[model samples]
Target: MEKWLVVLGIWAMCATCAVLFIRGATGGGSGKRTAAEKGVRPASRASAGDARAALND
Candidate 1:
């Protein structure tokens, strides 16, 4: 009975860890703001035609 209790405790701990990890990885309920989501564009962004023009010169 003691050994079974220990096994059950370990299993419960592992399940809790898995649930927390999955929640964190999926960003569950975390109101994080990304650059794109905030409508902020990077200065270095260029189109393919601009890159080609620069390379040909």
Candidate 2:
């Protein structure tokens, strides 16, 4: 019936979307980098001496 056809079409669309989403989520074809790999580093914790120097400024 037409209703069953509609349901099948919708199901097919959903399956396609899920496949694409999973592929993208897994980075199938593109190069990806982590923060460290991109040469980004987190700032080190400030020491007490650094705080004193800032207060003196």
Candidate 3:
């Protein structure tokens, strides 16, 4: 029982470490810009009309 507990503890620690390592390697969700940060403006009707006209040609 003691050995099993030890193995379980080690496995849990290893899994936690792996998750932390992967999160750090992938920038931990901090690198992506939010919609507000990216300055995404709403498209105007005229702009959409122009895009449709261009696409048709």
Candidate 4:
């Protein structure tokens, strides 16, 4: 009985991990904020560097 309980706990943990992995694969929990949502233009690497340069002026 004790051994069975241990196996069940491990199985549950693995199943939970698999479900979380699948959800992430399907974009279920992405917390990324879009530029529109933040009311900003999409920034590229060059634009970011320009912004920093401007700030240093």
Tell me the tens digit of each residue's lDDT in model 1 across 1-57.
999999999999999999999988896533433654665544544444657644633
Runs of candidate 4 with Cα error greater than 4 angstroms are: 29-41, 45-57
Task: Identify the runs in model 1 with alpha carbons over 4 angstroms from their true place.
Answer: 33-57
If scored against the real structure, what TM-score would every candidate get?
0.52, 0.50, 0.52, 0.50
Q: Tens digits of per-residue lDDT for model 4 on 1-57?
A: 999999999999999999999987886423444533564544543466767745633
3 or 4, which is superior by TM-score? 3
State the C-alpha lDDT per candidate: 0.67, 0.66, 0.67, 0.67
Per candidate, the number of residue pairs that clash is: 0, 0, 0, 0
Cα lDDT of model 2 by residue, 1-57, tens digit: 999999999999999999999988887533334643565433542334657644633
lDDT of 2 at 49: 69
Clashing pairs in 4: none
lDDT for position 42 in model 3: 37
Q: Candidate 2 has which clashing residue pairs, if any?
A: none
Clashing pairs in 3: none
